[model samples]
Target chain A: MESRNFKRVYVWELPVRIFHWINALCILVLAITGFIIADPVAILSNAEASESYWFGTVRFIHFATAYVFFFNMLLRIYWAFAGNKYASWKAFLPFSKKRWNNILHVLRIDILLQNEKVHDIRNISVGHNMVASLSYIALFVLALVQVFTGFALYADNSDWFLPDLFAWVVPLLGGDFAVRKVHHIATWFFIFFTIVHVYLVFYHDWLEGRGEVSSMFGGYKFIREDRLKKTPGNTKEKSEQPSESKPEDNPKEDEIIV
Target chain B: MATKTDTRETYYESIIKQGYSRRDFMKFATYIAAYMGVETSMIGQVVKSLETTYRVPVIWEHFQECTCCSESFIRSDHPIVSDIILNKISLDYTLTLMAASGHQAEAAKHETMEKYHGDYILCVEGSVPMANDGYCCIAGRSARELLLESAKGAKAIIAWGSCASNGCVQAAYPNPTEATPIHKIIKDKPIIRVPGCPPIGEVMAGIIVHMITFDRLPELDGLGRPKAFYAKRVHDSCYRRPYYDAGLFAESFDDENAKEGYCLYKVGCRGPMTYNACGTIRWNNGVSFPIQSGHGCIGCSEEDFWDNGPFYERLTSLGGFGIESSADTIGKVAAGVLAGGIAAHAIAANVSKRKELKDRNSRGRDNEKQLDD
Candidate 1:
């Protein structure tokens, strides 16, 4: 193996890491509880009905976690504007020409597996690749759908003003049954997303040797020094050791290596 | 048949003339007010309105229906309710109740349509068949024609049951007659939908009494159902809700759980999704509803409920994926296919990576040999 100079770049901030883990945990809880609520288990309780409240507890957990999930998404959206470039809303939306090009590049090298030669360092992204960022955007939309449908269904039983605001959603979607169906189907989407997301994270971690998995945890990723130098905005820091460059030192230079 | 009378009588005069005492009239008013979910303090106002308000002429038309709504209406718990609503209100044009037949009944309906104009209420008992140029007809006129003519000069329309409100069973899958609910046809009118298979007897009476007392349509929900009755799901006020909260459910009709009056959600009670006053007001004067009678609610009040079910199965079956396939089945199949594909891709990736590494290593050796030579 040839030794290559690497720069430890801070990519995911502390809030982004917190949001990622919290969002992951919330999705996990919401999916399980949501499915259970949809088709409740027929537990034959020989004890008095008043003595047991298991299904109610399950529903309570779902509703409670839903609040957490909703607020976590709001926090992530807030951070998208307030946080660094890596956590910015700009990264999530594939609106720019370069982002679209990166999406195609990722499709060829990672998904389609058309290129079997030694991996190109230039193709590796220091932040989220366009595909990943676009998927996150899709997930964000899905999250909004779940929130709307879930709250709309909850409105029937709740007197809270917040849930009441979603009352119009039920009628708009046709009825309660249709809303439940959409909410249930969207859960499958989350399940599919989780499967693909975890696999790609591990696959990229193994292939890139860039701490893709740990970056989500410790908020740092090791980028090749050459790739960092090639990045357009990082030219001012070219003479300095790339490892010594901090995002805070030059907040204006969003050194996104795609 | 009696001809069109020269003078119209107020509700109080009509009931008194029918041999009902003042106390009976007050009792009827209080009973109707309570059923309409009116405040106790407002009971006197209801009595005052009934005493002063003239009986609103009602044009009851039957279309594509089983006449169950008429049956339910006549059987209202307070005998005076049915008597006053049916007999005193100048019911004008119901085929089942009116003594006049053929042209006489038709004449009476037209007379009220002309005489009262915008002051009369049009009560529809069934859906209108849109297929085959209005398949359901009455007195040589299509239901749609009669409905349109009558609705043209009505104060407000009352869709009596699920048949009139949501097309009921006839509007189920592959609706052969294309039975459409009244609201679809008469978009201009203020339609109050009392949607049950045959909405509760008192509910039918309460709606009429509400209009008579308030001289206006009751507050309605988004679906045009009276918020007083359709505000809460049957499950919200169900007697068996405790069992549901406790995770106690009847697995089958004959199960011990069912015998013990456990929740019928497992056996396909649609109470959670169905909006109506069944759990509270019940049927037959608050005697008992379907859930209390050991049968799951068929969600009779909901739109297209017939298409929503097999009546005994839970809500797991998604209509989009065919009746047999549930969300769980579709989800599991998709997940399985994805897992298989992912496994195959992982193997292919590993094999290709190994081959690429071997090619790189062999090429490196070839370069070394060339340098040595």
Candidate 2:
């Protein structure tokens, strides 16, 4: 049996871990609340629920979760500057000539769908590779936009704080009705992306055994001894562990035979 | 109060000069008080007020709008709303109603402003166009200039309809003339905005009555609309609220549901979100509002309401089993299984309110007990 005790690198910080889990919860709550508000599915026809209105309750949940999502976003943005190299802006963009080639190669594959195994782990950093980084950025943008349009919709009859900030967008898309329609449609995008995102997380976790899911909450992960220590082509990752001994330049290619 | 008394005497003397009888004046007083939403007991006060106070000078300006406000004012629900508000009070000048033409009409308006200075009401109907130096001009004076000059001397400005309030439909997208609302231009003067495609005649009269009787503006909402008249959403007092709650919305205007007087939201009614007195004060001498006339509320009273959306197509967020997610949704259903949902909602609301009250009382008692201890 493989010994449970192994060298574990502390990759994700505590704030990052908390941010990940809280964001997941907030997304789930927001999604459920959003769909419920959009289309209230009645399970029992005869039963009348009167104490709290469905719209009111769903709206309360949506708004509360939105606050969580908003705070998570703010902290995440802050962490980009304050975090380690792996968790910072350098991790998010394709910079090197090798990665530029990979981006083009990946773009080709993205258009012509391929299995996830075909992608090279050695060619990229750990947290999020170039493609995944941009995808994360897209999601971040979507989340930020969602907060804006969400607040605008909420501000339709309420406080001016959100409305004043985003009032210009209401007129940009024709008028209030169009703005409302765009907001309603954007909600569906977030929902669809979230479904795919959760599925991918579980699939990758089950396949790679990299402990990706657990790392988000626990802030550590176990890497194989044979795998490249300095993120393969991405040598910038060397700063993380100052004391770990360098692997032999050419260790014999050994397959694990438990 | 003295200003009111003086205005009242002035009105009595004006009518008396015009050879109107005391009985006619008293009859007009009762009619005006009732239409103004004053109780029958207040008729004596209205009579005393009108009998004692003079008619207020009014300079009515017309711009990029139909003079429906003046039409509605003249055909008001109150007999005096027309007589006292328009011809009888002898409004100093209005473009549409005034018999004088060209220089005479201009001279009369100028005379009212120059004489009354700060006492006359400036009733503006329609939007002020702000293209060129204002291409929309009246008697060689740009509508903007005329509005400013008239407003400069006025005590209060009453934006009579949606046109004056939010530029109405004229200020919608691609507005070539740059129609602007009255308050947007006049920062110094106090304005009371009465927005509606054409406001309910009685409501228009009521606002005037409140101003005249109270000798001040009526209590206003955040939107600068009179609270007594514009407080409740059209949905709140709508006759079809029961139908809406019962989930019996009219699928289409020609459907059986429509015939049975169901909620018209599915067919483009903005009633659920729009606040106005149409559902209560009604229109056409208390006979009916638009909803009663088999038309969905157009939300003509709200800001940018003209551009909000098509009148039909139910709001995505508003419909469905509204109570399904409430505190007692499931609990109340169980309560109904034991009794009935009707009883459950009532009992649950009662129990919840009771608990709330009890908790509040307990907290208060705890504070008192703490002091005693």
Candidate 3:
């Protein structure tokens, strides 16, 4: 292996890293408990009804985790405004032309399996790639739906003010039955997302040698020195093409370091 | 030839003429007070209303529907209820019960509407079909026209059954006749909806008794259903509810669990979603309800229940993808296909990485030779 110069780039901030893992754990708990709530398996027990509150306990765990998930999402939204550039809400939205181009480039090489030109210096993203950021945006919207529907359903059985506020959602969507169906189907969406998200993170770790998987744990990524040298000062534009870089075909430039 | 029955007779005279003893009348009042969720002390008020009030006239209208509401009402558990409510209080009009037909019936309805204007109760038993200029007509007048005319003079309206409350099966998807519920068409009036497929006979009787005793509409829920009956879900009061909480469900109708009277949620019970008095006020004179008879609540009391999906399956079938595709089926298939794709892609990615490595090693060797030269 050839020796290569590397620079440690501060990508995910502390709050962002915390949010990611906690959110992942919340998603896992929520999906499992939610599925059970939808179609509970028979738990054979001769114990008295009050003594055997396993299903009730499962529901309680689900609701508790849901509260954590909801508030954590809200905290992340607040951090999007107060945290570092990579953690900014602006990173998730594809409003600018350059962000749109980055999204297309990711779709071409990573998703479409195309033989695209490798501009390693320009392609090395210090934070989330355009596809990832956009997906986070979508997932955030789905999370909001879960919160709204989950609380609305809870309102029927609870007296809490927060759940009561959304009580109108049940009738607005037709009935409690319809609301429960929507909530169940949305759980599957999260499950599908988790499977693909974990797979793609490992895939990127191997393909780019960028510590993509570990970066969320430590808030830093090993980026190539040449890529770091080419980085522009305007941080939000990190996903787009660098202002100074010109295309080069030197194979040595592909040498990645951690 | 109609001899105007003297308005002088009280409901006591009518019940006595129908062979109901004082004991039977008081017992009926107590039963009604219980069904209405009123205090035991309210039974005296109910009896007093029966004795004093000049039996409030009712104008019952039928539209695009089967006459199941009337059938359910007339089959009240006690003979006195059928005699008192149907034969006595419902004097002015009801298509099925009224002996007078044609002009005689129409004249009676008009006369009642005139005489008891702003005092009579309007009981609507079916949905009004609004397509093609009010298609469901009776006595040469559209149901919409009759509803508007009668409702204008009515003190309060009682929408009987799911048909009048929510348009029932007629208002199911792609409703050809444009059948709409009474409340939607008659917007200005305060309408109380008793929304069962054919609301329980005792529940129907209880509503009338409460109205007669209190001289006002009963407290209504968000959907305008009487809170006395619609406040709690059947699941809340179900005998098999403990099984649900314990996660013990009957997998199929004939399974041992089902025979043991386990929760019917697995057998497509709509109990969790249906709010009615079925569990608390058992049908057929408190003898048994559908669940007691080993069947699930069909969610007949809810709005657009026909469109909610299969009667025997949990979860609604997604609309526009044909009628057979449920959410679980679609979700499982989608997850399965995606999993397969992920596996295939993982293999492809690994193979490509190996090829890239081989090509890179060869390029490195070539570079070393160039340095040697």
Number of colliding residue pairs in each model: 0, 14, 0
The residue-level lDDT of candidate 3 at A207 comes to 68
Q: Between candidates 2 and 3, which one is better according to DockQ?
A: 3
TM-score of each: 0.92, 0.64, 0.85
**Native-referenced Cα lDDT, model 1:** 0.84
Q: Give the TM-score of candidate 2.
A: 0.64
Alpha carbon lDDT of residue B64, candidate 2? 88
| 1 against 2, candidate with superior lDDT | 1
Q: Residue B120, candidate 3: how far off, in angstroms?
A: 3.0
The list of candidate 3 runs beyond 4 A from truth reads: A1-4, A42-51, A118-120, A226-258, B1-26, B40-54, B78-80, B132-135, B320-323, B346-373
lDDT per residue as tens, model 3, B241-356: 87887777788888778867778887789998888989988877788889989999889998889988788777778997777998778888998999899888877776656655
Residue pairs clashing in model 3 are none
Residue-level lDDT of model 2, residues A1-258, one tens digit each, is 122222355678887777878987887888777655543432222323233244555667788788778878889889988986557765676665645665665444332323344544343234554666677778888887787777655654466575457645643443344455556556656655655456545544543456767877776665544353555433433234422223452232221110
Each prediction's Cα lDDT score? 0.84, 0.67, 0.80
The better-scoring model by TM-score among 1 and 3 is: 1
lDDT of 1 by residue, A198-232 (tens): 98898788666679999999888887676554556
lDDT of 2 by residue, B1-373 (tens): 2343343346667666667788877877776666566689888876766666677888888988988777777776656567666775557888888899999888888887887789999989999988765558888889899888999999999998999988889887667889999988998999998888888787887787677777899888566788777766787789877555555556678877787776686687778557688898787778888898889988888777765555664443221335223222433344345434333434443453454446546655766666854
- Measured with C-alpha atoms, the lDDT of residue B21 in candidate 2 is 84
